[model samples]
Target: MERGIIKIENGEIIIPDTPVWMTVGEMSDLFMVSAYGIRKALRQIFRSGIMDEHDAVRPFPYAEGCYAEAYNMEAVVAVTFRINAAACRRFRELMLRRFMEKSLDFYICIPAADCNHRTGYDAAQVWQERHKLS
Candidate 1:
């Protein structure tokens, strides 16, 4: 079976199309990490309550009369945060920047006083506080 296309630009990996599921081997290749490492990270992710296996993983028919465990995009992102690799570092940076941008955009849409009153703090600061990993 053909794995979906993956692109890396400016050290960040991107899946251009939706509904792209990747196996452990494929994700290991994409992130430049060992397959064992990927599996370990996945287990840690599940253990940490970051994501549920049933929601993140599914069975994919990779070949005739054969199936492999596949991971969804949310699982990919969660693992990216858990693993230690060059690609994972870059991906985390990209995700953090995007999250901050979105928080700032949301802040701009609301009055500063209203935002403070609604969240009891600055939106960006709240986001940073909530997303601090380790």
Candidate 2:
């Protein structure tokens, strides 16, 4: 990246952006694992509203792109406050829409990082929260 934002020296995409969300295939490629494993990890993310499904493609939730996004902690927490843990599960619901469904209506928005639109997430806090050590 000529923008001095991020580097991809070894195929490991070092993201300069935050709150990055990706599909099982992309996550598996990043993690160097199988898509099935990615799906396993995503089960929790989907339940947390940190990820969502996009029915536009089919009923398989493959369109996870249609709803997932980087959101401020306040926004997330605010939306979270309105939902219960059981409701977060993707088995029967899209956690994001149960919370911030309005974001789904947005057709155009700024990229999480520069030099490319899909390089990163919009909220560093979301990524930190997801990967943060407990």
The candidate that wins on TM-score is: 1
- What would the per-residue lDDT of candidate 1 be over residues 24-60, giving only the tens digit for each residue? 9988888899999999999998998978888877887
Q: For candidate 2, give the lDDT of residue 133.
A: 42
Residue by residue across 4-90, what tens digits does model 2's lDDT show? 122234433354454333444443343345656444544445567754533211212335555432222233223323334332232
Report the Cα RMSD per candidate. Answer: 9.1, 20.3
Model 2 residue 87 CA deviation (Å) reads: 32
Model 2 ranges off by over 4 Å: 1-8, 11-13, 16-19, 45-134
lDDT of 2: 0.38
- What's the lDDT for all of these models? 0.77, 0.38
Question: lDDT of candidate 1 vs native?
Answer: 0.77
